[model samples]
Target: MLQEKIGGEAAVDARALVKTFGDKRAVDGVSLTVPAGSIFGLLGPNGAGKTTTLRMLLGIIDPDSGTRSLLGHTQPLDASSEVGYLPEERGLYPAMNPREAIAFMGALRGLPLAEGRRRASVLLAERGLADWEKKPIRSLSKGMAQTVQLLGTLVHKPRLIVLDEPFSGLDAINQEKLEALIRAEAADGATVIFSTHVIAHAERLCERIAIIAGGKVAFAGAVDDARDRLRPVVRLQTRAEDGAWRAALPPGARQVGREWRFELPEGGPEPLLRALIDGGAGIDTLSIERPGLHDAFVAIAGASAAAAMGEGAPE
Candidate 1:
């Protein structure tokens, strides 16, 4: 099969991309493609270069090396019109009202002033902020401000949306609402990529994820595929009791608290099942506990972190 071009079937395609600051390499060499109309995640711990990578995609900063294509345009700033971006910092002018603020954002993206206001009106109403459309931005609560910021990002109907920690200030209710909005946007054929440190948001929203560490993509692919690639580990437990069963487990298992989990590297569950039975262990229950996104995140980034520290992972 032929390899797809960067953004060939994607909304954002970045290859061997790099950005540096003085002596520090902020984004080393990272390549990623976010498929059109899907929610993609870029994740990492602090200073892992996710923000820099995003900036390069947004054309806010030039990459020291490599290529990036967004929404059928390459290199030049005009390609930016195809995107909507919500930065990590809350960017609404404290004094500007929602109508003016959202419209200003649209204008930056080349929307006509009147058109931007028209769209903001409809989007604000749809987002349940209709009553506050004329209210000063500073008067709105954090959650309400977040809603308006989102309105600004989407008012122009860009084909792609890039959000940086979009849920930062939201309460649970607003978080759910915002997530629903994101999904709705994606369903309407907009590609979405959001960078976040919170695991749950990524787990809930992203179909594909890229784990970045020390300026590299530690893991990249569908969420399920990444976890499955790690191992098919199952946890067996008896009645919620904590004991020395971990020490008695087979050499292949890694014990977590009161559970024993392991992947049958070459085979299925039969050998492990037979071993459990043959050992005459108290078998209250057996369950295949698939690795959560957080687990995969830690495992993937952990190695990279160790590599950056110039030593193996701590014992």
Candidate 2:
């Protein structure tokens, strides 16, 4: 079990969450917890029921079975004012100007129209959309419109923000901007839960992550803990290849170019290092590489999930 870090109650919690559509189980027994003031990622491939899980947690859809608590409210709607959700389906009135669009969304979340408009103007200016604040959503670029929508989600100053596929259609520059915004929100003591098929985004921004595959939680914990599932790898370069020194290598050690790469044994690298030095192998360089989140995801969630992420899953 993963221990809660932020004290008090969890910002968001779901237990054995289940959802179904006809005969197909869209989400099966998914569960996750997000600590307050932390960036938590729900990572999975497309159509992996990530959206379904998020919707259920937000009270946007009823789960077939299971329980959820959002911002300490058993009924998510009771805390709706404190929660902000940006769905996978992006929608904004094409005819509405950026400021109007933002204020409208905020209004739906129970913010006063004047206050929403005020916050919208400030957010638009801060996000470099000041020049286009009066322009209709139809006139703005896709990236710019998406930014406006995200600003709307924040206009009400929600304590818990849930974003679904937030980086789906963003360019490199805009994606970086969004990442910074998420970090800023967490820094301001808000809990951010974002779902993404892109592994790199989670690897970069998430302190904790729950990887879902085939509608199930494959792994859930701190990023470091997930990566720790795999052993550290050792790469050594040596000029000596004598019979005595060969015995010092681990069982699975293999030569690739000038380096011998192998997984460090369970006893640790000290034993291997000692044997190599004692055997007089002319070691030029030795380095241990820690496994990354991508490796952990593949090892834990299986290759199919990794493959589904496709180009979005960066090394």
lDDT (CA) for every model shown? 0.80, 0.90
Indicate the residue-level lDDT of 81 in model 2.
Answer: 90
Report clash pairs, candidate 1. none
What tens-digit string does per-residue lDDT give for candidate 2 at 92-168?
99999999999999998899999998989999999777999998899999999999999999999999999999999
Question: Among all windows of ten consecutive residues in candidate 2, which has the lowest summed lDDT?
Answer: 306-315
Off by over 4 Å in 1: 1-8, 238-248, 252-261, 264-266, 303-315
Residue 14 in model 2: lDDT = 87
Best by lDDT: 2
Count of clashing residue pairs in every prediction: 0, 0
Q: Distance (Å) between predicted and true CA of 256, model 1?
A: 6.3
Task: Give the per-residue lDDT of model 1 (tens digit) for 144-212.
Answer: 888888889998898889999888778999999989999999988889999987777888899999888
What stretches of model 2 exceed 4 Å from their correct place? 1-5, 241-243, 311-315
